[model samples]
Target: MPRERHGTPPVGSRPMMSIDGLGDLWDTLFGAQTDPPALLVLITGAVALVVVSTRLPWRIARNAITIAHEGGHALVALLTGRKLHGIRLHSDTSGLTLSAGRPTGPGMILTLLAGYVAPPLVGLAGAWLLGGNRITLLLWVAVALLLAMLVMIRNVFGVVSLLITGALVFAVSWYATPQVQAAFAYAGVWFLLLGGVRPVVELQRLRSRGRMPASDADQLAGLTPFPPLFWVGVFALVNLAALLAGALLLAGPFLTDAGLTL
Candidate 1:
């Protein structure tokens, strides 16, 4: 009897693996999932709120926000034609994004402004995706962004942080059940929306105390006519507005189903 073949398939044979993978990728990117229960949404929001409000958890969670913060700077810098050098994330949850370009221009101003408001803006985008029942898409998009950011991380800590965060997101998007994915996605968006505001508030406090003199708001002040406090107020307003808008998008369906309006 001929030995049984246990090797690779002959050329021109059906490429089932590639076909199946493409199908899976298509579904994962564009599939519409059922909405998570309203209770789950509320619970996630509550958990995110507690995390943001509590100091210890906030310290830990702030790393994620810092990622978004620096990412925002890097993104805007590139968008505005600045040459992005790299990004550094610190253990203290602080981050620095270095870029080279015209020092005093609209591009520079926008890049400086991007850091403080990036989280909430990103949260709003996530909320919109969730509202459309694209939970998996949101998760995968996050993972993709992290992976892209990882390429530009200049410091050991930054690379490690991105790797950890990206791994968590990829694991959930790949291995977790739908319910688990939904929960994780909602909680993360909630955290971003809620967590985004705290840093701006902290910046104001530090600035008022005459600390953090060279902060983003101060840098913006130097380029523009506005004072540092004025820029801080602008950041607060944008973040707060994003929070409100994101909340409405995330909760609107639940409210409508329950015969409510806000």
Candidate 2:
């Protein structure tokens, strides 16, 4: 017979807090737990942060959104069989995604559109995971995305930004208490959900003044019969729909309690 286990198990068998055990901790912290009020507060706070950031031009607060934007283009380009050349991030909250492909084709059109749509789509996915109390999954997913972008970073700022962003997500996922991870994940999801809409409005304003040429909206207009203004409207509509859907998903428990679920 094997010896009786002592106060602690063997090294490999011990209940260690490794990456493999992240699920266990996440479950312990948020599994099957629904705190609607806290979730709402976090989402509201995230929206406020983005609103304030919009007022402050060229702030570091906006870089994360820019990274997500450019990364979106790069990702779609690769997915559509385009060769990604590089990505560059600027301090002015602008970014460029370089890829080798037909200049005017379906691939180009999709790559152009991906930047504006990525944030809200990512936020919606995050909200879905949060609704199921999958906080660890959210953090790890963020880390994976940041890392993927990091490999495509072709500029100093891009590399630095991606590294810092990846490190934060990794730190939160690997070391932070589960409650803290959950809170951060909620804030991040809300920020992405809300941050996507303002840019579409700004793009329209720029286009009206003839300042934005060759923008994603303008490129979309060239590809489709719809005008640039119409494409902007479509982007706005998508972001708004994502926002509303994310909010409802995040608040599902509360809505169910209020007999509002359909």
Model 2 alpha-carbon drift over 4 Å, by segment: 1-54, 256-262
Q: Positional deviation of 23 in candidate 2, in angstroms? A: 8.7
| Cα lDDT, all candidates | 0.91, 0.77
Shift in Å, residue 66, candidate 2: 0.9
Clashing pairs in 1: none
Most accurate candidate by TM-score: 1
TM-score of 2: 0.82
What does candidate 1's lDDT look like per residue over 1-262, in tens digits?
Answer: 1110007789998756687899988987899899789988999999999999999999999999999999999999899988888899999999999888888889889999999999999999999999899999999999999999999998999999999999999999999999999999999999999999999989988988998988998888888999888999999999999999999989966897889976
Clashes of each: 0, 0
lDDT of 2 by residue, 1-262 (tens): 1110008787778575788589777665455444545555456656646563667632666787788788889888889888887888876888888888777679878888888888888889988988887777778778878887788777787788888888988898888975677677777887888787778878888988999887888877877888888888888999999989987787766676677863
Q: Estimate each model's TM-score.
A: 0.92, 0.82
